[model samples]
Target: MRTVADALHDRHRDQLKRSQLQAHPLLTGCAPWVIRRVAAVADEVLFPPGELLAEQGRTPGWFLLIRSGVAEVARNGALLGVVGAGDHYGEVPLLGRGAHPATVRAITPVHAWVIGAQRFVPLVDDVRPIRETLAASLAAQPALVAAARAELASRIQSMRREGSNTWPGIRPPRRRRSVRVLHVLAAIAMFVAVAVGAAAMYHPPYAVIRPGPVVDVANDIEISGAAVHPIHGRYLLVMVHTERPTLLSFATAAILGHHRPVEHVTALGGQPDVERQLHGQFTKSQQDAALAAAAALGIRPSASGALPFTVRFRDRDVVGPSGGLVYALAIEDMLSGADHAHGRTVAATGAIDPAGDVIPVGFVDDKAIAAQRAGAQVLVSPTSEVYLAADSGVRVVGASSLREALDRLAASN
Candidate 1:
């Protein structure tokens, strides 16, 4: 541990990895240290010519950097433009607070570095050189994303204009038929059917927002392996879901706080889009949870699992990455032996990067109210609005990352 040779060896290894990233134009401007940091966590993936990389209208899950070869960006059968080595897509959708605009496919043998959603913001948001470099790259290829989205919008519009949707055995009424009487007759029936169907089966647009249980990870998890189980105490993670609202639901949410998905079925193109968002958010939550836990315990993430590494999210409406920080903290607590939460009722809100930086989220005011109502004694939130809940009669602490949040809670304990 005390040898000069050990320090030199580590630096050499880091430099070697940094050199691997230098081959890509997008990362060329990034300092060796930045490249080293990025290369450490990035997983490289290869795609053969003609392989689909990402699809249109789908939620974005990864930020890809083209290490070599070329890729095509298209929408509704129209080619928008081509992205070659150094050019990339997906970052706009990755952190721009929306779904992907178009489909992407490789045109030649390609090597790319995939950055999971959890790491996107934490890795690049505050990094000026990387962020600015990416911004410029995206700016240069505006048509790739912009034209594809315009094409999709035009296609959806065309579909509506063409009126090709002919219901089986149902035809348009003739002009002389005088359908006024028929329309009046069917109005009440249509309303009743739609109302009953949505009420009984479909969830509404209004989100049910409130604070949930403060579960003690060690006590709540049923881990079979002999893991370290580091963190402790009760975690107060809030629950937010969009559902079909009845008259009573509004009243309930008024007492509980309220929110909804910005991109609903109509605006987002439909259920598949929503499902894509859910899959990306939930999957990132699990992966980042494992990564954050490993970082805290000073162990490899794969090592945290005595057997194979696996975790699952059962919630169907987890629509976004807002709960990332909470998931990471929970995983950390479950895997380490130290009691970080210290048996205190703690709640936090933020989007966690794979690197563990906590990104701010919307609805801080509403979330704070919900947290206060949920019996949370300590609320950890992004540094920007930690004081947003100070007036809510709860102890509010600001944290810029997962480690800071844990440290605040642990220090209090």
Candidate 2:
């Protein structure tokens, strides 16, 4: 018995929910489509004063985004803080916590838009910006973070206390009577341990790519047998950390959502000897960079082989040709005696050929995160990979060749 007025009213309510989601401060960086998806799953709820919105030591069921009123966040009677409109909580549970770290109680009549864990956890696992925003929010609250850590210890102590007094009136069983039970329990424990060990050792089909350390090229590079010129700013070489995911790690990533996983074949390019292949590419890239630098500077290579100058990078476990563009820029900058970077921090990633053409590299988004973390102001990437880092919160410059990269850096303020 639904009327047209009821249908119109429902539609209006739905649109209002979407609008509220769009205006959320923490979700401002998220894509429109992601917000739409979240809005579709969100439900409006009201909590009375002194009501527990989320209880400590209980499994999380919903993620709340407050629209009005206020709530108190606490851990075992210790108040963490008060959150009102535009503030959020209930994320610690989504991050693989078996229980809620803190209790959220309504300080006043609370109104919020809530998404159940079934919907919210997947959204966080799929969307990178949402995860980053939530992580930053949690990090900004030091007291809440400490309470979360203490929650684990509190649970352990409570568990011990409960178990310790459970058999107060019962006498201990005789050793002879308990021998068979003990042996069976021991066998079961051994079997479980072996199974867990085997699962941890087994490799999954996916490999994870994560951001690695960013090295400032100006300070880390050594130039021997050449006139090294001083520069005013730093050039950074960004790297990625790769891991072959085991069952446990793969499952953890699937549940928690901070790491990205790709097919193993795609990651290593079906190479049998990944280390040697990457190392060879690294060596060739250095040579090509030096040659390109010399050619750009109008210097002919020595009769021996290449230029008389040698460029050596600090010893690092990272092996890849993606640093070629940065190396060439650093060498060219030093040899040309021009301050290309001026007074800004520049980070770059791309493979380079002897002719100074910049080749596209993989994982530029991850590299961009590393650059931002290292305080880089500008990131230079191949034209094809520039869009990958567009949302990485850093100024990205796309270049097709070495000359273009140099020109952009020199022109940028």
Candidate 3:
């Protein structure tokens, strides 16, 4: 009853499915029945060269398994690295509530298999080999991998107790500890500090500077350009320019890896509405409100007579009221002779608190793209934002505080 063209299509689809089953490392150990189930749920996609496979920071619908050619991974516009045949991408967001870490672009004519999450979950559940392989793959990732290992371990333990000896030579369970007794004892000694001799290397605490006499001269300067250069100097200073107090403080604190004094100034306004519109896909009034809030901060009229500080501008309007902490820090680093003068631009994002703790910001991919456009070589971000940097192929150092950022910069230089 099938026409010739229809028959050919079915044959091609079957061939592709067979290739997928044979090539995937995880599928290798799957039973024949499980493989057939996965094949039925999988779809094949062909893309022209230069096509966008996926966008950064967005949820993906499929777990892409590359079959041929190559894909370039990027965050914003910065290149993260390349993925080739037999490699899998998009597993990060597929497993979590967070957005996709990077964008994938086709570097050549390509073919790939797309498996929906709903279907993939069942396949993983039906096959132990798939679960084990995925866990092992994610094991190197501290956040996700640790959880995966723990879950896998628990599952294995439960199976052992049930007398399902699927995995042979497994060790018996160890004796349990007294949870209640340990909790009480640990709480009593929580504040005790024992003095050990100074370590061979000790990182200094991060200090945030306010509008003191030394920094007042550099507060309103405009940055002509910014780029992350190679580590030719012994120290580096990263600056963020935005009107969001929360973002500025958080960015500075996160990058510096310790609490530091932040100088506050009303410099420029940001495109909060545009950002919200782009990120949340909001309606007109909501977008307008965000824009209005961003527009509240007016731009400085001229760069003339402004301090010689490197000014960071969020939304390019120069009217935001924040980013002073980052700008001040960069200027301080430059003035303090910490190096980075030879065209190295370091990029980062965070909201600055009044107390100077750097908070996390959104659209990390866009910020990374902006940094790359400005010719940055090294980018530092909060530990939470490292995934964006990794997917974009940017060399990123993760810091929890200003001091930690400085220490990383020093070490790299």
lDDT tens digits by residue: candidate 3, 184-258: 777666633221112212222222322111112123333443332222322122333332234445455657754
Candidate 1 per-residue lDDT, tens place, 1-413, comes to: 46999999978866655665775667776777788768866777877545677887666688887754445666675666566545666777664545567778764345677888888778887577888876776677665556445545665677787777646688788777556887887998999888776656554543343333333333433444445454445676654433445545554455654543222331223345434644465567656766665566565545444334445444433444556777777777776656667776677776676667775554455567677777778878877567556787788888878888878877887
Q: Best by lDDT, which number?
A: 2
TM-score of each: 0.48, 0.49, 0.33
Stretches of candidate 2 above 4 Å error? 1-206, 263-272, 302-304
Global lDDT of each candidate: 0.63, 0.77, 0.49
Candidate 2 lDDT by residue in tens digits, 1-413: 99999999999877767766765667766677887788888887877545788998776799998865456666676666566656777786656454677788764346688989988888887878888888777667656556555676678789999998898678987676545888999999999999789879998766676888888777767888889888778899998766787888887876787876654532344333444545666777777888877777887777777667777866655555788898889889898888898878899998787779776556788999999999999999987568889899999999878989998987886
Candidate 3 positional error at 33, Å:
2.0
Cα deviation of 284, candidate 1, in Å: 1.7
Shift of residue 88 alpha carbon in model 3, Å: 0.7
Query: How does candidate 3 fare on TM-score?
Result: 0.33
Error of 3 at 259 (Å): 57
Candidate 3 — worst ten consecutive residues by lDDT sum?
Answer: 209-218
Candidate ordering by lDDT (highest first): 2, 1, 3
Candidate 3's C-alpha runs over 4 A off are 3-16, 143-413
Clashing pairs in 2: none
